[model samples]
Target chain A: MAEKKVIHFKIKRQNGPTGAPYWEEFKMDYAPNHNVVSALMYLREHPVNVDGKKIEPVVWDSNCMEEVCGACSMIINDVPRQACAALIDDLEQPIVLEPLTKFPLIRDLMVDRQKMFDALLKIKAWVPMDGSWDIHRHAPLIAAGEQSVRYLFSRCMTCGCCMEACPQFHQDSAFIGPAPLGQVKMHNSHPTGKYANEDRLHAIMGDGGLTDCGNAQNCVKVCPKDIPLTDAIAQLGRQTTMQWLRDMFVK
Target chain B: MADAAVDPNALGERYHFLIRRLHSLSGIVPVGVFLCVHMSVNASVLAGPARFQFAVDQIHKLANLGILKPVEVLFIFLPIAFHAYVGAWIWLTGKPEIMRYPHLDNIRYAVQRWTGIIAIVFILAHLWHVHWIIPGGTEFDAHAAAESAVNAMASLWVGPVYALGVLCAVFHFANGIWTFLITWGVTIGPGSQRRSGWVCGIIGVVLALMGLAALAKFKSMDVSALQHPPVTATGKVEPGAQTTGH
Candidate 1:
């Protein structure tokens, strides 16, 4: 008789936000095409440990089951990435899953990415112009070259992967992190978005603003969408300097 | 829309922008610029004890203008002290993820932080040994400079440690210049940054080489001749007060 093939997972489990975290090992029958989310789903169905004891099903957040949703971002094998995109075959066993340390943990592998969104809100990461407004017809033509950079910045899924990787983005710190900074670059580049550029820049200029970024360059490396975070930061640095000079003269 | 409430303690936002700017400005203007000058002066050891002493005397001569004290205190000491304290706070709060993430930038980031720390320790130790903790109760003046130079080379471990310190400090400054430019908005794109990186790299190598060359020169000096103080204008052996310590 052939022995049963199995996949192993070492998940850092927490009952709630304030609960102490502990690790639990789980075993599942080997199945083809099993990504991390699907493997977790298998664990959800069985709700048993490798020791043959029925246990609570593992908990994680996922919506798209694709990489786009950004809800399944966690530390898979000590690397913060999307669980939906991590295949079991590609990962070395036993796979380790933990929530991002930069954010408030909800439970198990899920974390609250609200701060990331809050940072976006603080930076006002949006074009001020209405979607229904067609002012581009009267304005000078925006070259495809300009749109290309904006397009790259628009791919951010707010996954918190960059935030997790950022050395400056800890829970106790005030750094706005790379995600919001990248959005500032994106929106500020837009034709109409430039109107409120100073406002956005001012928001980032304050407490957790641009100076807080240590230029670790970690944000660019971990970005799944290949956003040019460092470039945005560099550009913002120049804008802020100009703003400072302007302010200095005004004062 | 949620109101953008400004945090009172946010230094960058408030009148503290000057402080924040001073932090970055100090690193380059006084600290970074002074490192280059200090290394070049130290490199005079390549021409032997006489030339090295001469180089030291030249800097001391700045006192003739009655501005050297103020200049050193303001440009050299105060700026460095400010840069170090502010930097220590940032480094303490940072979370290095190179071990787990293993990305190139993350590795660089981690290295930068670690190097900054190492450089700070080395600088303090170097200052203490050279400036404050003079053996034999000798004031570290120009006459003692060459002997102290030889003293630092007397131990086998001292040379390598000195080299490592120079390497770390030079790297921190060089890599810092690159970051400083980006942070200040001078380098806006990949091309500019890449060019600036190459420039900083070249500067680092040159500075490191100059530092190591000085140490190597010190190692090769004739200790017998180094022990004797140089003659003054009156042809008498000048008493202690010449050499700058580690």
Candidate 2:
């Protein structure tokens, strides 16, 4: 039988967020369904390049070994995707791997996505559970339609894909980005979450809040969960109008 | 003492001030609100010639009133001009890399700003042709004004330009509405914000299509019987044209 095919990989390596980045190449025996994460594992076992010299084991991050966790996110062939799902056979020769550029580099393919999380906090993207325990005990059940809308919003993994794709989200920006806004909508719809609704609304009302979104719909397009971002925005418009009127009269 | 405190990053503070001011002003009333009104007014075209003409006449009368002109100059023209000016300043000062990449944020911002410029041009030309150029002539007559509007609508140059202007205006307005909601804290959470996004997107497309349809099917008017008789300083028509007046 002829010699089995081999897979070649080129990865951009960074020591830390402020450290210099460099490229490293490796060749491994091809397996029909081998993925980038598996290849990296293989490299960990036998750390050597095509030139036949031993080297340091490659560094990267992974938790779920599945796309759901979003911990394995990296730029493969210049496209941001989870390494666990990127099949080596499907990728072009010399499969390139790099860290997600939208976040601060931790090391190698690892990045700090804390900014996205911080945005979630800034938007107060949570429903208050207070009074809900008593209310739900006596309340009428949710309708199928309401459940479906809630279900759509429940899919957000805080994966930062929407933030990564957003033009308005950047290092310099205080703009909370799209994912957090979706969270705000989800929480506000909750019976308990509605209590803090005014506070949430007030937070986003500032200059760097929702006003920064340019509505290119790029976040929606890139969202893996198919979240209805633009719809939320429109509803928020009417809600804010009502809120504004209510605030004027009440306070 | 609190008010007298100076920020070490004075440049940043200054930049923030300008940005916040522009951002706040841009959100006020929003372009979408104006587009909604414009579309509503234009939809009157479907009510047949007399009603549409009467509506137009009423608008002209209201606009020409001596007291409202300065208010119009201040509120309508000044806000738009200032918005454009500050937008340009922001664009120029922004990182050049942003211009090169044309990311979604940059594209949306650029498109909105450029469309404002386009709208300004369209508004000026529209005002010149319909209000000043057509109405200022000795041949100025209602029939002639109606004919000019129809002619402008039918022209190869004007037809496409108007259609494009309507599209741009609607898109700009809808996008602005979406952004305005965010600015005002309506879509603060991740879930609701995302949901609001879809709503804005759908409305933007729908409103744009509606405006486009109105412009495309606008009915042309007959102007052969147009006659102009002299009027007094108080704008009262002479006896010969008194029957056609008002």
Candidate 3:
């Protein structure tokens, strides 16, 4: 018989958020079209180690299985990216999987992305369109030029890749990271969203806000959505400066 | 919604905006502007002892007019203190993962922080060495200036160290001008940022060249010719002021 083609994975396993982490190796029968998530699923069924011994199934998070929902994000071969999009064949042997170091790890490859969501909340990363009923005939028109830029930012999936690569967005740091800043730029461009612009700007102007961005710009490089995060940072920098001036002179 | 996101009147909230903006403002005005001016002032050495001492006399004359003291404190000293204190705090808190992110921008980020550290130390040491450390070796006295300059070249590797420090300081100031513009939102889009990068790059190169040229001028001077003191504004060296250290 021809030698059986195999795929190897070296997953960093943990029992809990505070659990001690250790690497466990497993090999699965090679199959075409297997992504990291599906490979983990195959291993989930087998639960067998490389030593031919029964073990616990590997744990990870996934929703869309496509790249859109970013729950399957993890460190694959030292790069933080979406596991669902990381095709096993394209990756090197014994593909390494670990939780993103910048976040609070849950178990295996899962990490709590609450900090990113909290940042979004802090920045009021929304259009205040849901308040008291004042129904209008038409939605506010946004310029095509502005929409193209806003469209780029609107693709953020709340994945931690940007934060993972950010030098200022670690667990102990107060910097809100770049993801929220992208949302800030996106929402602020909306004709309705601009009403709360100063409020959004005010939220980011504080300690953990926009100024905390170190301009390392790894966030832009690592963003899965290809968001123009640094541009948003620069835009926010400008907005806040204007706000600062306005605060000094007008209000 | 969510109670207006963040509190507007909190201690940190109220001041962080102003403080951060001021931080960038100080970098441009007092800090960046001062670096350029200091380099120009130091470049006077290229004109030889007479012109260099003339420049020194003009600066000291500002003290006689009582303008230099206040200007130094407000523009130079105080801004430096604030910029350094705040800058050090920011630098310390950063989570440096330089090895992973090897992008040019990321490296520039780390370089900026490091150059700030080098610049602060260099400025302090340079100030003390020229202004306060050596007796009668004030930069005003051309002979003492020459003695100290040669001593710096030979003693404990001051010349190379000073040169490195000045280079780092120049890098910090020049690179800082780019960040300053961004932080202030002066460069909004990629086009503007690219243009700003070129502008700041030219500024940095010019500043570094001016500083190095001044150092080169110091190294080129004939040590024996600077043995005698030049006549000053009062036509007298201050009492207890020896012309040379040894």
Candidate 4:
């Protein structure tokens, strides 16, 4: 009888945010269409390390178990990505996993992504509902070009990969970073949000605001959602200038 | 003192969260947008002092109007406050050990943040020296006023400050411009982003030099006329003729 094939894995482990980080190896029985997350689940059922010793169940955060949620994001072979989408067959042997670096570590694979979310709030990354709360209200018509731009921005899943890959984003930064700038582009594109456009412009106009970004472009490359962060920043640049001029003259 | 009353942890929790949000969004305006305008304005100096001064006067006039002044104040104050507040907050909360290294990416990021600190100091000093101190109504005569302006520029202390300010401004602007392009999605591909960075660096240096030259010219002018008063009934107004020894 032929032996069943198996997949090997090496994951960086940490007990908590402040706990010491270490490595553990595991081997999962090969199955068709298996992904990193699935293998992780298998290990959860049988929490044993390669050293032939029983260990605590590996800890990680995942919601959708699919690529859409972005909850299963981690570093695979030093590249930030969604674990759910990483196929075992596609990765090199001894698949490695680590938490995204740019965010605060929560545990083994979960990192605090509140910074990215907070940035969204700071930028007012929303269209003011105004009188449109009623479902019966007429929806605003969006031009095709505008729609395309908004669509590009809508892809952000609040995943921290962009932040993780960004060199400028760190524990010591007040840099609002690139992800939120993309959100600025998203919200500003909406007809309703355009009403408070000047406010949004004014918000990012300060010290640690847009000016803080060093334009490394690493954020866009690592964004799982493929949002056009760089483009949003440029548009905001032009928009803010107009706003600055308006603020100078009108009020 | 008032902040001391609040639970340090809770205060951190509430404000830290909001500040992170504000910091992230703040990039769209002052730093990102302002850099573009600043660079373009500095470029005008290449056209000569008249054009540069004209632009400055126009900006001042527009910015000084009643309603506009408040808004302008907000524009300047909010971003600086938010950026500084958030930056300090992050520094306080963040683990600095991991960031102490000198990777290329890390070095650039650190430099950018440090420049923010430098720019903030320079800006405050600039406001004090130029807007408030020198032009705030010390000199009664035009010549004296001009002399004061020139003297301010020529002073050993002030010269380095101006030079540093220009350098910091250009570095900040160039770095922000490079990031602005990426955040906006203008330079997506690796090749494009790298090329854009190079272009930004070159342009930033040129703008910095132009701004420095403009500032340096202010110091090079002859301030002798300023030191001397208008010829009076006497062959020349004694050094102490106009009492108060201005």
Off by over 4 Å in 4: A1-4, A132-137, B1-246
Writing each residue's lDDT as its tens digit, candidate 2 over A160-242 gives 77676666676766567788888878888877778778767656655555545555556676666788775666566556556
Candidate 4 lDDT (Cα, 0 to 1): 0.67
**Residue-level lDDT tens digits of model 1 in A1-251:** 89988899999999999999999999888998999999999899999987889988888999998788889999988788999999999999999999888999888988899998988888778877566857556754568998898889888999999999898899989888999999998888888888788778778777667888877788887888899999999999988888788767975
User: For residues B1-246, could you state the per-residue lDDT of candidate 1 as single tens digits?
Assistant: 214477545555675556666788888998999999999988977755655776777787787888877887888878888998888877876878667777665677677888888888887777666664324332456555677668656777768788999998998898888888888999988799889999999999999999999988777766765544464654333556333222
The best candidate by TM-score is 3
Task: For each candidate in turn, give its C-alpha RMSD to the true structure in angstroms.
Answer: 4.4, 8.1, 4.4, 11.1
Please give, for residues A1-251, the per-residue lDDT of candidate 3 as tens digits. 99999999898999899989998999989999999999998899999999999998877889998899888889898789999999998999989898899989888888899888888877788887765777865787888898898888888999889999999889898888888898988888899898888878877888778998887879888888888898899988988888877877996
Which number leads on lDDT?
A: 1
Which of 2 and 3 is the better model by DockQ?
A: 3
Q: In candidate 4 chain B, where is summed lDDT lowest over 10 consecutive residues?
A: B137-146
- Per-candidate TM-score, chain A: 0.94, 0.87, 0.96, 0.93
Instruction: List DockQ, one per candidate, in order.
Output: 0.51, 0.11, 0.57, 0.07
Number of the candidate with higher TM-score, 1 or 3: 3
Q: What's model 3's TM-score? A: 0.91
| Candidates sorted on TM-score, descending | 3, 1, 2, 4
Worst 10 residues of 2 chain B by lDDT: B1-10
